[model samples]
Target: MIGLCLGLAGVVWAQLPVSSFTLAWDHTVEKIRWEEDYRLTETGLVLEEARVRGNGAGMEIPEDARLEKGSWHYRRPIPPLQPLSLGRTPQAGDYQLCVEGDCHALSHWVGAPDINEPAIQLWTCTRGGDAQ
Candidate 1:
């Protein structure tokens, strides 16, 4: 009975709508390329870009900095996932870590169109003059 209860709880938690989600892509050459969060709402999508400042050999982007004004757009919404891997790539692409909800990481893009939507389409960044 305890095992069944835990399984049901897991299922409920998985179904709960995620308040917000983040996606990060680390580029050593650029120190930071793409690291941002997208919040879901009844209206639409809200995008917040990471504001990083140099801190010795490391970096720091404060929570206040993340609260800086971000843009919002309307797009086809996707279901919330609990640390799920959205997509995968065979070889290393421009991004080191392509993350989604709850630290779900995707390394490469095999060109599979499973999670390819307008929301992900607009949430892109340019590195060294090249679009990723």
Candidate 2:
């Protein structure tokens, strides 16, 4: 019983590291618009910020959305955000930002579809600098 409890504690502690999530529009001129960062906690995932770039603007997440079973739940109604499904899937180079120790790629369809917005593509946590 004690051993089982210890193992469970270790698992919980391992999840303490903060992970970032970003939503950016694929544009021809600017490339990216808004990028958001989220941190994981014992209670749930928290939104750190939603950064808008160079004359670009977007709707902000009303509150911190908890990550439940790999899905995010916001407190209030949010704007649309999801991947484009014009039939042909995008290649890695089309939307992937690669760097040392980290890579930001378009997020797969995870979580509820009804609330997912189609205008913004997801980005993984980056190590250093902007997505190139």
Candidate 3:
């Protein structure tokens, strides 16, 4: 039926666009709690810059970008790209937070663990239009 066809078209339209992914740190090893914010790029419509707040230190993502401090609170202006990543080694304590966006299907790891080692959660993604 036309109704089914139209519904499918709208679903495709709302899907995420092409995106870039990168990782950054606070120049520290252990992160107490980290929040990384991503925003839209001007032309590329891709994920360009990411801001990470961890261990009292903050940084703009891409590792080679820049360092800034104070506040990991979520704000407007979704980062460019479809996905981005922030890096940190979790402390021995417990912390809870969100990684922004619809990135849930993405995986997490620390230092790219060996196949045999237990996977450490260091990265994540919001649902990619299919989390449900």
Tens digits of per-residue lDDT, candidate 1, 111-130, equal 22233321112221122211
lDDT of candidate model 1 versus the reference: 0.32
Q: Give one clash count per candidate, in the order shown.
A: 2, 4, 20
TM-scores for candidates 1 onward, in order: 0.32, 0.30, 0.24
Ten-residue stretch with the least lDDT total in model 3: 1-10
Model 2 over residues 1-132: C-alpha lDDT tens digits?
000000011121111112433333354444544344443332333455444433333443344655454434454333322111211133212233222335444333222222223222222112331111
Task: Give candidate 2's whole-model lDDT.
Answer: 0.30
User: Which sections of candidate 2 miss by over 4 Å?
Assistant: 1-31, 56-101, 107-132
Question: Which runs in model 1 stand beyond 4 Å of their true positions?
Answer: 1-16, 28-33, 53-101, 107-132
lDDT of 3 by residue, 1-132 (tens): 000000021232123332333233324444543444333333222333445554333433343444556534433355332222222223322222223433332222112323442222221222343211
Kindly give the stretch of ten consecutive residues in candidate 2 with the minimal lDDT sum.
1-10
Q: Which candidate is the best by lDDT?
A: 1
Cand. 3 TM to true fold: 0.24
Full ranking by TM-score: 1, 2, 3
Instruction: Report every candidate's CA lDDT.
Output: 0.32, 0.30, 0.30
Score residue 69 of candidate 3 by CA lDDT: 68
